[model samples]
Target chain A: MGPQHPSTHGVLRVILKLDGEWIVEAHPDIGYLHRSFEKMGELRTYTNGLPLTDRWDYLCAMTNNLVYSMAVEQLLEVEVPERAQYLRVIVCELNRIASHLVFIGTYGLDLGAQTPFLYCFRDRERILHIFEEICGARLTYSYIYPGGVSGDALPGWLEKVDAFLDYLPPMMREIDQLLTGNEIFILRTRNIGLISPEQAIDWSLSGPMLRASNVNFDLRKESPYQVYDRLDFSVAVAEQGDCLARYHVRVAEIGESIKMVKQCLAQIPDGPTRAKLPKTIKPPAGEVYARVDTPRGELGVYMISDGTDKPYRQKIRGPAFVNLSILSELLPGWKIADAVSILGSIDVVMGEVDR
Target chain B: MSEEEKLENTETSDKPLKPAGKASPGKALAEVTPPDPRLLALAELLQSTFGDAALESVVDRGMVTLVISPGTLLDTCQQLKTDPALSFDYLACLTSIDRQDHLEVAYNLRSLTHKHEFCLKVRLPRDTPEIPTVTSIWKGANWHEREAYDLMGIHFQGHPDLRRILLPDEWEGHPLRKYYVYEPDDVPSEQGPPEHLLIQLEGVE
Candidate 1:
């Protein structure tokens, strides 16, 4: 049994009570990285808080931006320009692909396979480059504004993005060959972390986790937002509700996001990317909730405004937070090695989890 | 696909429950239920069951907000989940707001069976911010409630293993609260090792 260790990601100190190399009980001691990001939002002006949202889910900054912006927009009763909506769709889908790539790479590394990790990051770099082109920075691009995007897409950037999209399929094929069909990979993942559909629903699991359990509930499909209503895609679901099933769902989702991006690029119209927002943004006295399907799950934002520049209260509904709730239920009775695999299957980023 | 099978699915598995007293006498006898009217029925049922406990307020541009009290939180959630007419089986999200004056808890509940959603809120005072845990009903509420407690200093009673989730155990102050002060300390820096330091002539000079 491992003692409480610091480098296990986040401040997650787990005392694993093991018997003969098998985990008997895993007691997780968290709260090492807890920043009250929710309470902080209530203190800052609506615009100032967008950057903080970027920090929460650093991997999928676009989704966080969209969720928070949507909430603020709801409070202010402002409609973003259609062009801005299209831009959001494109960036979000790109972010989804990047996040899925990290998921694939990290899951491989967790299971003692290193080659796929490198291969996945090779693709991730290209996505990061595209993001850098859109916004000057790379890691936490706080580009999505409340009324619209920060600025217009750079000159000839669309052509470069098209080139990237064109080459993504062959790279994805290489990833599949390297990990998906390998016998060892299948054995490690197939039935390792089994949770039933009912269990998933009861736990409020969303995104790939819930889809892996065969509940076809994608917010993109069930509650279409932005340009999702017009996009053609499928909510990838599987009945296994195991590690392998979760992996497959995420893989399939990568393909669907690629498809959505293609359609968005093709149908993107020429118009002003932002609306005429007021200088000092003050929303009416009311509450609003907005949800966007992040790579992890449904990233929701709820804001209460008391007719002021700052919010009365802002609550960020992080998908990782809810998804991690089921970990205690899943870890016991499984081998310690399987615990890492299951954690990977849930696809938690401590930034969002600990936020 | 048989008539009997279709009838059974509609009667037992699909349809939402009928609200007592609210259902008209003539319609109550007829019992003609529509497909997946659970969310609609739930709104009506909640209004009648816990009259003032279920407070509906529009936030922003007509976005529905239903304020629920702490005491009836568990029963309200269970009814939304188990009742076929109002099966809000999926707790999409659970989060909290730290008002220096008061702590606000929000639950985003969705019906996977019916494809509908609604928000539930409960406010607790800052001096004694405590609310019942809904982990018994949704299980997803466990981490969320802990997060609230961790960040906003709200206590979630009956949480199986309630402790600091996002912040360190030894770490002082909740960073999320408005009144949390960020005061820097006056500790002096440790001196560098003498062997590694640059030479300076003092007594010899």
Candidate 2:
């Protein structure tokens, strides 16, 4: 429905075979915004590719940068400073909240609730303000470099972010009370787009979508990377794999991110924000992979370098691309109105899907 | 000290007893569940199940990667997914790499039950790259195989709907290969990319 429509998020075109209100088959024809980011990554130097990562998933650019930088760091065997790792976790968790807030707001819009949309965006604006203060840019913040973040957190930035952590829960509760208990929202979402746990695993669904179906596999909890091992948080899971269950998973995650942010604020040590990097940063001849738990799912980068400034090949295993692939399976036999709820529940950003 | 005493004291973890050359030296991965040291055990288990079907295996950066014969790719993956001890139900990521000498397809599989992972790779000839599709085992390989076919031009023999995914249907060349040269379409291709994509490709040699 949308290579141009608002609900599909970005330039994603889905071809639906339907009989009057019943969807027969649906295929998402993506790649309308294909920038050839991997080809560009192959052409650019190791560190020059950071900004390009920012463009793939604009909603969670920090996680993109974190994944790519960890890939290069694994190849080069350079250690990131303790403070930079802490900062990476902080910014990534903040972007997770911002990205999920967008999902809640837009999913509310899809289900025909306009007031919750305003509430979600009102909270998201504050997160963007904190990002703007840390880096100069808001939407595409290329603040995270290969070795470390571009700069240290400003003197008052941590406290402001801590205040934000406290500020979001009550509003999130407002969102929950307004949307979660709404009878119509339940009528639209419950049992409408159900994906079984076996189906979710075999179909390679991840993040909240997989967890919603009672799978206990989170990359943060299972394969903890970058200071995630130090932080303690529970993986939010739901037994029913429905559109409403997806909402419940993200809502629970917002609270967990707040707890993790509080821990980082109290324990973050004072030190240099970046590590020592060589002038011409060329990783040795080998391949390394690194993955992180982004707001969407596992955002992984597989890079092979042949002792040169440029990468031999860089493949971004984007979570949105794989997560969106299962729409055809979940969309059959549902009414056309349920299509919006189903697709929006997947929360795909076409930027990453197309890339 | 007795010989039995020395053998018992070594270590009971899943780590390989042979001390194979897979993980790079001196890189200790202590985070998260102490980085499972049982890489060699997984390799031996696979070898025990399928004798010569498992070709050569290596460890790079603490990841246990096994290179399987192209002919046995389907059977190896089928067993890896269904086996009770090694049920790798999750297909995390799949893509092909062009090594200029030959083409290699990589499959990263993980077991939610066992909490272990395996990297299965198959090398096909550069000229005619074809392998059996694992879609019948895990449906996630459907789009991944299509992407590999679209960008890298690796043919999945049994993939039900093998179509170009990221690029348009009428595009000329597979652009991911090192020596891939794009021949312009007579009618400015179906969703033609913008002019800014032009590259000299001059100094790439």
Candidate 3:
């Protein structure tokens, strides 16, 4: 209904044809936040382009940086050090938790549960503090780069993360108690915007959206990148494929991320974080598609290098962009209020969608 | 578990944790590594099925890429999706590239059941970059094809609602094209709201 409506979540305007209170048809009119990052990637060197990735899907900037770096690393044919790989996994998973926390808080606010929103942000702030210690920025941390992370973890940084991890589970339980099993929340979300597994797969729905529909396709488990294969965790899935199921999958995933981060910290080795490379980064002429399982879904960076400092072509397959496309197919036949619930479950950041 | 125990457990696995980069410095990345047998077998199957339509196939960076002629794009995609052995149901990505000489569209397809993925490329002449849409084969191709059409100026023959996606409908010149020049003066100055928007605004109160 708007490019500014709070319930629509960041510059998503949907034109709806309504029959009384029910939507007859819905068309999502996106692209209000297009910055043309691909064009910018063409104009910058490989190292300079890392900051550009931080802008897309700003909620999980670490994973965005990780995927772009992975693509460049593949083209450069460079190996990241063992400790740097572990650091990448730790930060990416922590960012996943932070991003999901935003979803939980905002989704609660969208569904008229204000207390859970406050509780979620309270916990999310602590995670941001941890991120700030590591990267000096809370939101757009270009910490993960090609060949390695920007810097090694400072002394006692691991202890702070461990302390925060211990503090998080109890707070998460408080949020779960506040919203997950509440009668009003269940009434608003259960069976609303139901997507069948077949429909989910055909539409290329990913992350919690696809997993909620019973599709067990997680890029981390299926095709491991960084140190994901070393960390042991389960993919969170729900069979219902409704708004409630999506909520459940995300809540469960936060727990899994916590477990993975714990594993990364426990097994991190003492070594250099950044790899030695030439001053100029010019990857050989080839194309490589590197994908990472972000909090939202698969973030794939398709890069073609012409053996030059600048990329010949770069395309980002943002998961939120693809996941939000199903709104036009799913919105009809539901009431206008249910539209808010459905859109919240999709959890799209317009920066990624419009990029 | 202790750190040493974890290290020992991981080291015992035959498969290494890191996938070593195959390309040597200053060497072409695609030329260094030999094609995987599985990829070769899949390429053979595609070649046997499509004959001359499958122009060339190569394996680079552990991904098999099949370059097909634009004329056989739709039929080849349909077979790729429905074929039991190569049930590429998931269209992971659709990207269009301006190669300066010619326009190319790449389809990154993955089969959920088989857990194997590959790339399908279609080359079109720069003057008339047109190809049949694969929306019938994969519904997710809707926005992807629209995006390719919007940024790269590649026309999809059968896209149901092909329009400018990221850029405005009235915007001229696809910016992703290699030859496109950005003119700062092209930016429209501030003006009154459009007639339709004003009409909608009149009913707000």
DockQ for model 2 equals: 0.24
What tens digits encode model 3's per-residue C-alpha lDDT throughout B158-180?
Answer: 88899999899999999999999
Mind giving the per-residue lDDT tens digits that candidate 2 earns over A1-355?
A: 8788888887888899989989999988977888788887988898788899999999999999999998987676555666887898899999999999999999999889999999999999999999999998888888878778999998899999988888888998899888999999999999879989999999888899899998988998877776776677999999999998888999989889989988888768777777777778888787766788888888888888899999999888989898998988888899989988998999999899888
RMSD of every prediction: 10.5, 7.1, 8.0
For candidate 1, the TM-score is 0.85
Minimal lDDT window, size 10, model 3 chain B: B25-34
- In order, the interface RMSDs are 14.5, 10.0, 9.0
TM-scores, in order shown?
Answer: 0.85, 0.90, 0.90
lDDT of 2 at A200: 92
Q: Report clash pairs, candidate 3.
A: none
Model 2, residue A164: C-alpha shift (Å): 0.9
Task: Give me candidate 3's TM-score against the actual structure.
Answer: 0.90
Instruction: Give the docking tier of candidate 1.
Output: acceptable
lDDT of 3 by residue, A1-355 (tens): 8988999999999999999999999999989999999999998999999999999999999999999998987776565677888889888888888889999999999989999888888888988898899999999999998878888888999999999899899989989999988999999999999999999989988899999999999998876666666667999999999999999999999999899989888888887777666678997798988888988898898999999999999999999999998988999999999999999999999999998
lDDT of 2 by residue, B74-190 (tens): 878888888899899999889789999999998888899987887888999999998999999999888989999999999999898899999999997798988986544444566
